[model samples]
Target: MSPPPEHRRAPPPTDAETLCRTGRKVIATEAGAVAALASRIDAGFVAACQTMLACRGRVVVTGMGKSGHIAGKIAATLASTGTPAFFVHPGEASHGDLGMITREDVVLALSHSGESVEILTILPLLKRLGVPLIAMTGQPASTLARQADAHLHTGVAEEACPLGLAPTSSTTAALAMGDALAVALLEARGFTEEDFAFSHPGGSLGRRLLVRVRDIMHTGAEIPWVPEHALVLDAVLEMTAKNLGMTAIVDAGQRVLGIFTDGDLRRLLEKAGDIHAVPVAAAMTRTCTRVTADRLAAETVRIMEGKRINALLVVDAAGRLIGALNMHDLLRAGVL
Candidate 1:
């Protein structure tokens, strides 16, 4: 038997060598790409922004393969950040999706080489429709670049891929550049959190940013409350019925006087008194944290977290109890 094929283990790299070689190469490549972009921010970039801003229709982004994936993400980011945008695969655009593009819209095409045949095939039709073109590519002199109304160069010194055959560093640079453009436009248009929430109504950010306290609070008969003169047993029943771990103690006018919680019940049980005979008001916490109905659900979360409490009473400007919420409500609403 040929001496059992000798086993070899990869050598460990020294820290300084790793930093000086691999780390430095990546940093240098990305830095060079970003630095090159600074001077390249010419009239073309401004023209691209202006065209997109002036568009009466949506921004149509198109690319092929890896560029297509990046284009899809860029479209989503733009759409959520105040710009109405969507992605169209260059191959599909050449087929029938080209109908999606309108004369009033702007087209953003992506290709590292700027020579993707799929993308190039649709250029003529876009031009015929009078759609302004913004090309993002590594080759500034390629066909797409030459044909575009604006060319955003995304050239890098070298790719992070070991074989330099993959679209690793180039894709990252393109994604970052796309983010820069989206954020710039978002800020220019004074896009607010509410605007972002409208685009992402199904997400946690939307719940936290757009949901108001009143929307989630238990109101009307759902609120677990008892008169200040109610027996401790009545408060316990109210807390148990509501399952909120607490009950609000209110006066006759529905103004919150104090809050009686499971903690108060526990402490009260240890005292030399009958649970049924004690007035809940005597055992309630007088200084409970309260919020307004108009407050953001996110703010309510912050107040609860900061105060180390699980529930809050919603009050009006005059301090009358309007609603109540527990941590469970926030969690269920996707605001936590």
Candidate 2:
């Protein structure tokens, strides 16, 4: 006998082609919506950016329903890209949350229809507080847009949803417009990758941009080094003790004169049986690459890769050895 209806296996879908076609159509529709925004970046877009850029407090983004979700994301993007911004729920604003908006703040409200009752209810309060308002909506003639200091039209030709109920292409347009505003403000403020890294210090991007060579390099006694006049055996012993596979040959003042690696020792061993008596300076690579302690660790990785070397010595402005690092150090520091 067959199992109960709820436990029974369902038949495989016979409209796989229809599913794929619908999915592709949705993507194409959304792409077109986003593309149309390129033309909408006119005087109004400039006005919105100018208002946000000049905001002394923050860009307060607010919306209801699906628009709220998009507004939240826009606020996050703005905050991360060097703009001071945060999201406020329109519905909650009527219930004492309106206190969050100060006179110095600029309110960015989103509603595709421009008639969200929750947002409209707070308009009088915003006006009383004399806070500047930027509105993003499909209806340019609606109350929100008419009262806004700057209006960004994110109108879409149609929804990708076949039933015409769900927000699909319109939300995509609004998101793209939000990103454009954020990137514009970022450029206007001269925000750099290093600045962005500070906002995201817990991520890999932060590690790559904020981790300096001085922060990761082994210093003092941990640095494998030998006197320039030392024998090859002494350099080898230092390399072994430090386990960095190389040793720096420095002068009396701790200035790097040359570098000796395991490869050089191997070559020397092949040519001469008595390496113990050979001077380290004679076997070292006279011209070697060195980096300053202030450099980004990511730059050191590129230097090592380009020159086909595994280790580097860090020096001060006067060319005195200060620290040392190898590929293993980079890996341990999460820079590799």
Per-candidate Cα lDDT values, in order, are: 0.89, 0.94
Worst 10-residue stretch by lDDT in candidate 2? Answer: 10-19
Error of 2 at 216 (Å): 1.1
TM-score for model 2? 0.92
Off by over 4 Å in 2: 1-18
| Cα deviation of 254, candidate 2, in Å | 1.1
Whole-model alpha-carbon lDDT for candidate 2: 0.94
RMSD of 1: 3.9
User: What are the per-residue Cα lDDT tens digits for candidate 2 across 1-336?
Assistant: 989999989885669897898889999999999999989999999999999888899999999999999999999999999999999999999999999999999999999999999999999999999999999999999999999999999999999998888999999999999999999999999999999999999888899999999999999899999998899999999999999989999999999998999989999999998987899988999898899999999999999999999998999998899999999999988888
lDDT of 1: 0.89
Off by over 4 Å in 1: 1-39, 270-276
Q: How many residue pairs clash in each candidate at the backbone level?
A: 0, 0
Which 10-residue window of candidate 1 scores lowest in summed lDDT? Answer: 1-10
For each candidate in turn, the TM-score is: 0.87, 0.92
Give the candidate number with the greatest lDDT.
2
